[model samples]
Target: MDKRLSDYIKKVVTEHGVTSTLKMKLLLEVFLRQSIFVNTSLPPKHNKRFWPSLKDIYNHVAAQFLKLRDSCVDQKLVVEMVEEQRSLHKGERFYIRIKKDQEPGKFTDENFGMTKTEQSMKLVNILWEWPRMDLPINKGTGNIQGYNIATLFAKDIKTKLKEILELEEGDKRCYEPHWRHLQWIDRNDLTDHNVMNNSVKGMEERNKLFHEERWAEMSALVLEEFGLFKPKTIIGLFSPPGYYLSLKNCNNGKLMATLEDETGQRLNEGVRYFKDVLLVEARIIIASVVKNITYREAEELLYPLK
Candidate 1:
């Protein structure tokens, strides 16, 4: 029979540290030997691959797949794929496909590209850069025609983020990771109150859309001393006597606020702002007041949820 593809795949397997796995051999055989439904108008090449049992094919394929790593693949290509995926701004959507280490993976029409609806960015490299920098992706960017470099990137971000941050399996985050906070803030002047308020709103949206951790409570001391600031979307939850949860819109900017006081009660948008804020708490210190009567101080800071 025509076993060219199968033999080639086997050779690849061996080159990548896989000696002999019946499952992989069988997988290559099936992929090469069977009739795949592509360009449907073509005649079927109905050839049954030589496999006595399913287990053999599975183990072989699994072994080869598990061995895939940076040493076995091109890091530059993978990084490019991920950056392209993020630039698309499609959000957390991705497709999975196996490809030759030297060649781009096959893209089938059946797979739909990743979307932002999921909240978490599933792209690869997420954990790798964790506790250092995060990447921000917006919603409704574009449509991916197929799986290739972009798909690899979407997968790598998650894997790398997890690796760098030492994230456990259960340590889940709901927001897509964002890295643009510093860049965006630095681009504008924060001295003007209106500008600061505008920047705060942007920061709020950034936090709301893409936090590193899920938190049941978050607080910001919106001092009246800072002048006028409006609420965007408003809500109230259980909180101490001096504070209340408020959502504000300032000069066309939107913000979600959680105000807390010494009474021990917590105030924030209960379910409207966050999809699932189940943890005790995490914090992001946007701005603060720490002067006599003439000025205030503001800087971006990150905190963990209890």
Candidate 2:
């Protein structure tokens, strides 16, 4: 490995005591696994994983996924609307997330597209440092090309991870007790270069394509922030007034972050995630969110009504 890469791994894993961040997990998957697919394996430094009993599995599937199943419409229009929202926000400077069902009286258009809220900037600056930093992707190939990382794809990873960790059965989030171990990602996400549901691409690809210079500027911002500021805590990035939820894990500098306010609480202390664990989680998040289905309702999205 290049010395730079080696040093980064150590800095994140050993020096800082942060075993996993959004980008670090993706980087390991691309190289070690040679593919950006579903992953649930954790770093050896962490404790051994556990499995959910049959009841736990059933309950987990019901709590996290079944709700989406019951609510999901699984129509092409839903995907299109989501795509449109993503496209509209593709150019903003900071990360954004997609959310609905706003708490009554809490929703406001005033901050709908604001770029520099105090909480958002705090989270954004957190992202510019260690575990919370941007993804480790190669931008040489345009995002349209298959295999290159995408912004939405990375955001979905966090979405999936948050969902999986909330599961009653999942433990350390790796290896089989059974099919549940693969909960972070799924078979549907295996496609390459799928920027959207009907559009078709890999699990970690982004929908919003930015100009090269803008991409360069965002990527560079991380280094500049890191050189000057001290790293912040990597936990609990959600804010209550409603957020765009962009994780910014990839090189393109798009959305990447937690799904709900409680997601930050789910990060298991001492958990050290690597390539396989995070990739799988990414797949599941994409499937659940963009596909508009729970695990059971995935069939509806896969074969929607006419």
Candidate 3:
């Protein structure tokens, strides 16, 4: 990995903590490409339309990364790319406020005459500016492809998860929605329909592509952060009634987490070998009770140890 890339990873992790592979990959791709992909349903800034498919974007970035591996791409360009990607990946969730006279749907060269509904729709899209992860339509549940997105907010994953788990009693431990933002779209908007008609299929494919490409970047970031990084074990945490901590040894060359019970007893029930393969594939690791730490901490600790 490039030093600049490694530094950027550290900076993000420092700002956010343990980042998901998806987030990291998106960051790298953005930094390298200087282009950001956003759903037309949302608007933030002005950028030219680029990729037709998420796969196309990934392939282009991956190829670009490879080409620059030894050739030394411009660091300034890489930095700008990173900034642009960050903007897109974590763009603001504002909506456009359609004026009273403006239409509520998409205004075109033919129908630039906007209606109330069209104005409202455009305003909402303009405010939203980017595809939000909060909508049921954009969740990991209805994955048309065999791919899902995982995001980790550093402030939450490491510190808040345990706290949230502890705060809820029984299965009724209600928590706030963890996604970044909710995207609002007017079902009545013609622009939205046009966007969907033109981009939905490609959107799904691009989602998968972004998900995969981000993981690749994440894995590389992890290795750069902690070379030969591997989790010793992992433990699972469930609640009372049948709540128990399950621990499993992951010496089998896989990233695993150890869950500890309230009494600190390690069970053999959580993510075992080949179980948390996605974590390893994405170079994500969890902390264990024994170390009272996470894989991210271990990786960072190694930096000083060496």
Clashes of each: 38, 37, 39
Which candidate gets the maximum lDDT versus the true structure? 2
Q: Write the per-residue lDDT of candidate 1 for residues 3-73, one digit (tens) a residue.
A: 54445454566564443343345455445445542334423434434332334444444455445554323
lDDT of 2 by residue, 76-95 (tens): 22444566777889865443
Q: How high a TM-score does candidate 1 get?
A: 0.17
What are the models' TM-scores?
A: 0.17, 0.20, 0.18
- Superposing all C-alpha atoms, what RMSD in Å does each candidate have to the true structure? 25.6, 21.4, 24.6
Task: Judge candidate 1 against the unseen true structure and give its global Cα lDDT, from 0 to 1.
Answer: 0.29
Model 1 CA deviation exceeding 4 Å by range:
16-45, 50-56, 59-134, 137-306
Which regions in candidate 3 have their CA more than 4 angstroms from the true location? Answer: 35-233, 236-306
